[model samples]
Target: MLTVLMLGDSLVEWGDWPSLLPEVAVINRGIAGEMTEELSARLMDEIDACPDPDAVLIQSGTNNLLFGYILFPTMLITMLQRLRLCYPSVPLIVNSLMPMPIVAPHDLEQINRELAVAAAATENCHFLDTVGPFQEQCLPITHPGFLNDQVHLSTRGYQVWAATIKGLLEQLFPGKLPG
Candidate 1:
């Protein structure tokens, strides 16, 4: 099974990754309410714990937004640089901030734009933009993607996220991952 090291905040921590991606070995290093700066600070330790992962996926910055740090990509870019140094040949997947009721759409768009740019500039890095997929999947009022807190994801939301990850992994690894 392909091993993926996932790092970030609650989104990564709370996910039932083993069940979500049954075919892969997921090493989740997520801390709830963690900010970009905090993640950067402990990033090395996290990577050290999982010395030889096939890939790394990061989904941070939402907590930073809650703390009113709009331009989080600056710190995120720095963190990505460090990650590249640690895992030069491994594929790095950077997840865009999901659209939430708390953040304005424009601000989310701007943040995702910067994230996309950062991923594009990094070698072997891939960007996963979830805004459109989430929006499309949660169109029905009864099937809202977010939990009651309007920040965390609901089951439907996770399905969308998992599907997206699976698709990307398939592309990155070809037939290595089960369909």
Candidate 2:
């Protein structure tokens, strides 16, 4: 079975990916209220433990923005570089920051753009633009019952997220999942 390591903050911590992608084994290393710097510090050890993941999924930086840090792009890039150093060949899927009710759409858009560009520029890395789909459910004006709170996803949200990433995973590593 394919093993995917997911690392991030509360959004990732609350997800139940094993249930969502039954074909693959998911190792979640998410910690609630974790900032980018903290995640960076723990990343090398986490990757060392996994050592051979088919892919790594990350969705951090929200807390950095929430805590009033202006260095999100730099921090995120550093984290990606660290991951690359640890697992040079493993595919890294960088999911865009989910839309939050409190953060301005324009500001969030900028951060997502920065992350997308960085991921695209990195070797063996790809950006998963989840903002639009998530906005369809999480945005206050377009809420479709996917998010429990303004920040965290509900069960339905996790389902959506899983489906979205599954498609990309299949594309990136076709036939890796067994029946």
Candidate 3:
């Protein structure tokens, strides 16, 4: 089975990855309430435990935004750089921060744009644009993609996220992932 190291905050931590991606072996190193900086700090340790993985998936920055830390892309890029240094050829998938009711749409867009630029500039890195898909799936409802707190994801939200991930994985690994 293909193994992937998933790192980040609550979004990553809360995912039932085994259920979400039954075909892949997932090493989830997600910490609830963790910010980008914290994730960067602990990244090496997380990687050390796993040693090697076919790919790495990161979903972070929402806590940073919630704590009013808008300049998180710099840290995220640093984390990606560290990952590249460790696993030169491994695919690094950077998941865009999902839109939340608490954050202004423009602000979220700007942050995602910065993240996309960073991912594009990095070798062997891919950015998963979850914004449009989430928006499209949860249309007409103000916050169907999120829980009541508007920060955590709802069941429907996770389904959308999982579908996006599955599609990306299939594209990246081809016939490796089951249909």
Candidate 2, residues 1-179, lDDT tens digits: the string is 88889999988888877788898888988999998888988988897799889899998988887777847778778888888988899999998887776778888888888999889878999999887777564544454424545677766667778878888988998888654
Better of 1 and 2 by TM-score: 1
Q: Is candidate 1 or candidate 3 better by TM-score?
A: 1
Full ranking by lDDT:
1, 3, 2
Worst 10 residues of 1 by lDDT: 136-145
lDDT (Cα atoms) of all candidates against the true structure: 0.91, 0.82, 0.90
User: Which pairs of residues collide in candidate 3?
Assistant: none
Highest lDDT model number = 1
Model 3, position 173, has a per-residue lDDT of 94
lDDT pick, better of 1 and 3: 1
- The local lDDT score (0 to 100) that residue 87 gets in candidate 3 is 93
lDDT of 2 at 19: 85
| Candidate with best TM-score | 1
Q: Give the Å error, residue 143, model 3.
A: 8.6
Give model 1's clash tally. 0
